[model samples]
Target chain A: MNLYRAHVLICGGAGCLSSGCKAVLDKFNTELKAHNLQDEINVVETGCIGTCDLGPVMVVYPEGIFYQKVAPEDVTEIIEEHLIKGRYVTRLLYERPASGEQIPFYNEINFFRKQQRIALRNVGLINPEVIEEYIAQDGYLALGKVLSTYTPEQVIQVLKDSGLRGRGGAGFPTGLKWEFTKNAPGDQKYVICNADEGDPGAFMDRSVLEGDPHSVIEAMTIAGYAVGANQGYIYVRAEYPLAVQRLEDAIKKAHEFGMLGENIFGTGFSFDLEIRVGAGAFVCGEETALLASIEGKRGEPRPKPPFPASQGLWGKPTLINNVETFANIPVIINRGADWFKQIGTEKSKGTKVFALAGKVNNTGLVEVPMGTTLREVIFELGGGIPNHKRFKAAQTGGPSGGCLTEKDLDQPMDYESLVAAGSMMGSGGLIVMDEDNCMVDVARFFLEFTQDESCGKCTPCRVGTKRMLEILTKITQGKGEEKDLELLEELATSIKATALCGLGQSAPNPVLSTIRNFRDEYLAHIREKRCPAKVCRALLQYSISSELCKGCGLCARNCPENAISGEPKKPYTIDQEKCIKCGNCLDKCPFNAITLK
Target chain B: MAKANCPLPTSNLSEILDKYKQSPGSLLEILREAQAINGYLSREVLQLIAEELGIPESKVYGVATFYSLFKTTPTGQYIIRICESAPCHIRGAQDVLATIEKTLGIKPGETTPDGKFSLEFTSCLGLCGVAPAMMINDQVFGNLTGDRVREIINSF
Candidate 1:
């Protein structure tokens, strides 16, 4: 390969692609050709560069100049000034949101500084569409080594020594799950990759699949070797089209390269994988439900302990792992168990990927070491809460997780630590909430999600979560009695205890965690009939401030309800009865005349 | 590469089993190909696959229904998947959903009377920032407003 003078790698992940990274890359290529520097300068499209909010991000390697929010038009200047003249585009460089300092290197940004990428190790570094790129980066090496070198027992033993647990919510030991399937009495066994991530604010699984499809393929192959399974299925949601497309492409290339089909790498271990598209069901994230879906049944949960490992798909022992968990297998195999063990805390060894979203400044995918504090992820890496809003709470683990307030900011991010902080490491979805967010509304939101996603197989999850949501809705609307809160707790506990699958078991977490940490907010909503955050629509009353309302008809004209009855150029009085409280008038009012009481 | 052509809706279970008896893990592949031809995995297909693979129909049915991707019923002309995933939910997807329901006058997971649209809620469409998003047919519309949703629906 001829060495180019420079490589301009642009982020081609979903975030940047939507933000016009493809146009930016095309323009860069055109400009490079026009400038006759095509031979010298090469433009490449890589996976996610993590700082998704500041996309169409580009990194000029060798110099490693980090550019944010680049447009197609900016490509000319970049080629003219940076590429041709060898002068840095200072204006295009990423400026610190707080200090306004120029950030030169991509890693120097707070978003990337704290993250320790392991599952996302190859993301943003390689072209996901190509197999050789994945191969060159030690992609299928682990599967090759495991099939050729290690016995099924030895492979499981190595995984056990590595201390690798499932990153897919449950935190069960990956090695133990493999062992169960391996030891089970069955002539035919199966391996499955659970890519049907149903969590809100979670994209870690999708990112791994989109950025490194081969990793999952290799991991599943290794899993097949360990569990003595000849076949595997990847149950990915059909919503993830890009990830699905990339995975299909990767699998085809793998088969063509003789990596996936019979006698792989010249070994006798034969394994192959096929993609199973999920038809938009959240309950399918549960292992049993997932297996049921793969078997062409309605996506619903079943009782475990005849767990998937003992009698999974078609009554055959099956070992199932999520995308992120599979991404870690090759790394754990390449680097010895002890080396992988040293990165994280004692129990939670190895890094975890989080889809950092919500009120944070830099919203994207982040992978941090297990012991890293929540404060670091929020402040240093997340670039603090946006719009100078005071940090109120952070919701982790999606619907299955809980809320953590300021008091728990210092808590480490490992599976146990998050659980200890009234949250679980449920698929690593970290949604930051500012002071303006209503705790009551937040709880109701999660309850509604769980209620909608419940497979309706078990009574507790099917009925219990709905009752809890009803109480929450009543409370948010200022129609709740004091006993409703107590009833909520009682119902939550019952549902948690009686639920059949993990979905039902963890559904009460958000409600339980919110009540535990923000009990006062609930009391205010129930007793004072007031939403502290002023978010509850029914609790809010739109009032025209006599001091500020200049009788500007803007408020009256814009009101969808025609509640502002005051005459133009005179003092305005908002009729409380007719006010719908949509906030349109408040937003349109120039003098800040309208207030929500 | 020779495409293995099995009998359409195989009648005899034992004969089907004998044909694919040597191939390991032939159950899912044979069933999928069979379903692809038949539009839906019928009981006859299940029984045929089970007998050919020396397994029971109950076992085949169990595997067929284990995954969400497989469908036993026939689908409509266009599948309109509204992402009820977390990000979309936060962006007032519930409101968008209400608008869709009122406009189409059909709840989610239901096909319209004309069979033009089959509405369903998916987990995530991978377009979070453009929240409150949905995919009508195969085209994805992000940062959805009720009006935009209506426009997309009308177009379909």
Candidate 2:
């Protein structure tokens, strides 16, 4: 084995890959060879280091210098100044926006300082494509320990003591679920990893799979042992091709190393795993719907009580846990359950990884303790909202979650506290909205998604959600009557109570939460026939300010419908009848004269 | 009926079917790989897959139609999937989408005249941190601007 003097870790996660990390990695290869340091220096392509806003990011080991926004051209400077001369690159280091201080080390940076990485511990540190690096980092140690020393009942006890709940939105107790599947009378019980993360703005599961695929594999094997199962299936999304590729590679490597397949570590325990790609259905995130899809049927949710633990996967008992939930298992066993229980809140133990995005300065994946406040996540860790915009609300849990306003900023972001604030932690998709955002429009946007993705399996979810969306759409279109608000409340309540599944039950959350938190915005849309945030196109009236209009004819020429009319050097008038409200004229105007009232 | 030319060789299709013969639940994988081989899932190809897997033709067709990833109609040489999720919507996704539409001379669900490009809106490609992102085939492009879109399509 060869050891490198210095290692340059390039982020190869989907987020960084989209931002040209591939180009940056290629440049580093060429430059390191050009400097004749190729043999001595190592460039390892790893998974997401979480700070996506600073990509293409790289952290050079030995010094642990954290570099941000690196380009292909800057490769030469990094190799020559940092690697060759033994001096850190001052310009490339991540500078704190608040203090303007250049922090070279990753742990020193505020964005990473507060983060407690258990699921993402090996993500940016080891090469995922190589299983040896993962093994060196004590990757399969927990599985070996579990199979060698502990019984199935003992393993379940550890999970129960740890208080680990499902991170896949519902927060079900994982150990209790495992115990049920074990006790359930079945000759062919199975274990499943739920990687079908359909929450629109969330990519936490994707990152875990891409970065540390072995952790999930090990966890699943442990789960297989605990549940008295020989077969495990990972139901992943087809949209996440990178993650799928990595998981496939990891499974193959584990098989080769005897960690997978029939007998492992000279023990009689035998487990095999296979990957099943989901076909673009949001409802498949639900365990029963996912099982139906695996059985080659349409992804639709069914009634519970005969839950997955009792009867699942071709009417056999199955243990199903979310990707993040399984990712925590190996760590819980290796470190012991008491350590895991001490980290998070009373009921919701351990950290939750959030796909932090929208209107914030630092947009990336964040893993904070379950009890971390919304204010710390948004202001301190996220660096506040971008463009100096005032915070309006933070929309958590996607369509299933409600909006958290300023009053809830101090609330701890655990499962119970978030639900108490009128929102549930639905897979940790924290979308921060600013003052410029329209509350009614946000509700309408989420409603549109839920409405489109509704499986039509039940009446309340199918028809009731449609009715609620119709009302929300009308309000956004400036055609809402005063009575619409009361009607929306009535419809939302009934749907929440009568819906068959979680999707239908939580479908009214965004609507109900917006009305509860920002009733003034809805009143403005309905009563005043105005969108105070200027987002609803139907409420916006475009006109040229006479004093500021240069009459350049740019707007007239650019309009697809030719809706702007004027003479040269004279103010133009918008033909609102002909205008399609496409906002083309506003984009074309050079003088910035057009105003939407 | 319109399957005059074969997208993949007959031997490759048989091999793929044989690999998944034991696992009946691999319908999603079979459809995904078949779509990748062919530009879209034509009825003729679906029938062939159904016969190979020993499942009914109607069941195969139903599975194909259930997924958003499997296209029933032929796509352009280049497929551009623009994300229109809430995160992207908040961060100028509309403007970038409008720019793509204007540049390509097509709407969200239409193909170009020469079949060079097709524009479609996807739910989310999970690149929300870099909002206003699009996937051109398997390669994702993020933090989009009008110039970036122009450069990308022009290269293709």
Candidate 3:
């Protein structure tokens, strides 16, 4: 082994990869070699550090100095000044958005200060491709302890006592599910990791799989040992190519190190793993649909009474847990159940990872304790809404969740509390909205998504969601009536009651929750044919403000339809007949003359 | 001379099939690789895959058509996928989409006349923080603006 003076950890997560982190890494290599410090310094490409807005980020080890948005040109400075001279680069560090104070260390940043990293413990800290780094962090110790010391019953009991529930949305107890599969009459069984993360704004599972691939693999092997299974499958979406590559590499490395494959650790127990990449289907996130897709079928959900525990994945007893849920298992085994039980609320133990996006200052992945309030997440951790926009609403749970208004900001962000506030914590996609966002349009956007991705297997989900979307579409287009609102309510309630799976049953959540909270916005759209947020283009009538219009002919020249008729040095007029509501004239008007009524 | 004589390649097809021939869930994997080799999945290629995998042609075609990733029709040199989900939409994805459409003279789900780029709006690329994001082939572009869209397409 080689000892190094300092290690440079660059984030190679998907967000950073797109932001040109690869170029930065290459620059570091060249600069370090040029400085003749290549042998003394080590560079490691790690997974996401959760502060996605600050991409192409790097951290210098030993001092643990954090750097943000370091481009290729800045790598020379970082390598020469920080790496060689032993001085921190003040310009590159992440300054607090509000306070404007530069925080040098990763843990001191407000975004990471409140986070309790159970699943993401090794994400930014270790190189996922290197097994030795994982081993150094005590990876696979849980599996080693389980294989040598405890039986299947005792392992399941510890999980049960730890009160770990599924982070995949429904909050099912992980231990009870394992026990059911273990007790099921079967000589052959299987364990599966649900990495088919279909939520649009959510990337928790993708981050975990990309950053700490071995954590999930180690936990899956432990799950196999507990559930009396010898084979495991990780079903991941094909869109995440980087995640797939890391997982495949991790599995290969594990087998070479005697961590995976048959007769591991000389305990005479055998287990193996394989990867199944899913074709794009939102419904495949459902366990039944996922198993069906893996079996080379059309990826549709089957009715549950013969649950996955009883008859799953080829009609045999199988244990399935989300990627985040499985990532918690190894830690629970290493640290006692009592230790794991101490971190979170009474009902919801451990931390929940959320992909916070939209309008917020610090938009990224955050893992907070289950009972953390929405105010703390959005305001404190998230650095509040960007551009000083007043908070309008926060959309949680993707299409299956509702929007919470300002009043619900103080509500505890857990499974039960979120549900009580008219939104279920469906995979932790918390999208913040500002004052300029149209609530009705927000609801319509989610409805359109659910309606398009309905799978068409069940009647209520396929047809009923379509009906709700049609009503929402009409309202946004300024063609709505008062009776349409009542009709929408009726259809949403019926769809909720009659839909087949969780996808169908929660299809009306976004619509229902918007109506429950932002009913005034809906009424204004229907009654007055006005969009207060100026988002509904169809409802907007473009006109030139006579007071401010200079009639420079820019609007007329830019307009594809020749909507504006005007002369230079005089006020202009817009022809409603020719106006297309394309917002071209609005963007062209320099004096802020064009107004939409 | 021998390569020029053969219009289509069948060399990697056999190797890919041999690797995944035993697995029951190899149908999707085979279709993906076959599509990659040929750029798009043709009837002849599908037939060759079915014959190599020892499965019926109808079943192979069904699996290909079932997946959104598999392309039956020929695509352009570059596929530009813009995320139109709620997060991106709220962050002005429509403006970016309009700009791309105007710049390319092609709408979503249509290829340009030059066969250089095809524009399509997908659900979410999972890079919501840097909203109004797009992907050309496999490379994701985030925090996109109208000016950046034209520059990005010109580079491709």
lDDT agreement with native, every candidate? 0.82, 0.89, 0.89
Per-residue alpha-carbon lDDT of model 1 for B42-142, expressed as tens digits? 66677767765677788778767654444465445666778776566555787899889889888986877776666777666666644666766555566
- The residue ranges of model 3 lying beyond 4 angstroms of the native Cα positions read B1-8, B48-58
Separately for all candidates shown, the number of backbone clashes (residues 3 or more apart, or on different chains) is: 22, 0, 0
Q: DockQ for each of the predicted structures, in order?
A: 0.21, 0.73, 0.65
What is the DockQ (computed on Cα atoms) for candidate 3? 0.65
Candidate 1, residue A207: CA error in Å?
0.4
Pairs in clash, predicted candidate 3? none
Model 3, residue A112: distance off in Å is 1.1
Tens digit of per-residue lDDT, candidate 3, span A114-199: 89999999998899999999999989999999999999999999999999999998999999999999999989899999998888
Off by over 4 Å in 2: A582-592, B1-9, B52-54
Model 1 Cα lDDT, one tens digit per residue, A99-172 = 87888887788787777888998898888888888988988888888888898999999899999999988899
For model 1 chain A, the run of ten residues with the poorest summed lDDT = A291-300
Worst 10 residues of 3 chain A by lDDT: A291-300
The model with the greater DockQ, 1 or 2, is 2
